[model samples]
Target: MKEILLVLDLDETLLYATTNRLIQKEDFVAGIYYVYVRPDLEYFLSQLAENFKLAIWSSADDVYVEQLVNKIKPSAVNFEFIWGRSRTTKKRMSLTDEYHYVKRLSKVKRKGFLLERTLIIDDTAEKSMLNYGNAIQITEFTGDPHDDELLLLASYLEKLRNVENVRLIDKRYWREQVKSI
Candidate 1:
């Protein structure tokens, strides 16, 4: 099978970590921030591993990113790489005063991945905007125990894996669903 790179985001995307609460094993507390993984996150990762070469590209620093990832995939066998803010470039959004750390697919391409065969799964659209049609913008996971987005995403991605060029799979499938609402 041809390999397709599936780059994932950590915070708010696959999991939600807040500094507002007491820290636990499930939570990664760095200085003052508390990070927590989404429910069924492990099963979600396992399912995706069946169809894609997974990698985590979080905007968080290296230490924090690895810590959070280790909490989930302790053996790190399912992921191909763990990329942090070091691989990202910062950009200030024109629409807002806040700056966004953009994770460009070009970086993944530089790592030898065919751009057409790669997809970025991030909750924040702004983070994956550069990739356009090659992204799956998910709703931010706020630690909801009943969240089923990943489960549905795994099904969608598995189906997408059969296609020669995943980029041709219009991201509008999710957008259409949103429009009907």
Candidate 2:
């Protein structure tokens, strides 16, 4: 089946990390992401994970991100991976952008995703090059599941995961294949 590797953002994208609208949480003591995931979170992610390979990218410290991800998703429902970073270690570019994330995803080829079927879901369209076809800009949630936008994004991700088969990149450009076809 076709697969997707997700580089989900921590704040505004998946769930708010803090109430003050700050990505950097200082007063929380442990310096962890602080926010309550919405009720639709589980059902939405459960469906998405069924068809996609998940990876968390918070820009939050790896150590802290792990704890927070575990708490937010204890059942491992939608998270196949738990990553933490905005900029790739080598290129030093922001991964929130589809171009950067696509490049960033390439670095981990040997380690994960034999197929470069990856996508980034974030609230901010900070990076524009990949904005048109490769992304879904979600409105940040504030513990309200009634919000329609969050519902739509979740539904969209779930639907995106199924494409019959996943192709391996192996010395080839996956995006090129998608574009050429």
Candidate 3:
């Protein structure tokens, strides 16, 4: 089977950053923001890296993304790419008149990765709305130290690692699927 490329979102998916500090201790500081890492993040990344080629794509500022990634990334793991806001498509919501950055999988295809073998994990639906087939929407991680989403996601993704076409899977019920496992 072909290798799958697992693209991850930084903010609110793997970690939460804000100017105001949370009651829980901050994992690290990136520029003006205090960052809180999701529980079991290191183990999650390490586990996934063994089965999937990993990358990071975030809608956050380029400098901030780099800083955060540098601080959190494990020394032994390598990412295929680390992209920031400059790589995202900015669009205004018709109903809210609010602008949000969207991560288009077409950009990953440009890099020669097959869309069928790619998956993007993110918290916000709007960010991956254009490519829901390849998206696995996770709950937003906002400095919840007790959150075990990553642990569950690691197990779920392991089940998907060998699939020929990741996009064909119905990931909307991924949490339920994990529970069954």
Top candidate (lDDT): 3
Lowest lDDT block of 10, candidate 3:
24-33
Off by over 4 Å in 1: 22-31, 74-76, 175-181
Q: After superposition, how far is residue 181 of candidate 3 from its true place, in Å?
A: 2.5
Expressed as tens digits, the lDDT of each residue in 121-172 for candidate 1 is 9998888778897889888887666778877777677767767888877775
lDDT of each structure?
A: 0.79, 0.54, 0.93
Clashing pairs in 2: 17-34
Candidate 2 to truth, TM: 0.62
Q: How would you encode candidate 2's per-residue C-alpha lDDT over 8-72 as one tens digit per residue?
A: 77655666555353443332333533465655666666766666777676655677777777766
Better of 1 and 2 by lDDT: 1
Candidate 3 lDDT, 37-145, residue by residue in tens: 9999999999888889999999999988888999999997899999999999999999999998999999999999999999999999999999989999999999988
Error of 2 at 88 (Å): 3.4
> Measured by TM-score, how close is model 1 to the native structure?
0.87
Clashing pairs in 3: none
lDDT of 1: 0.79
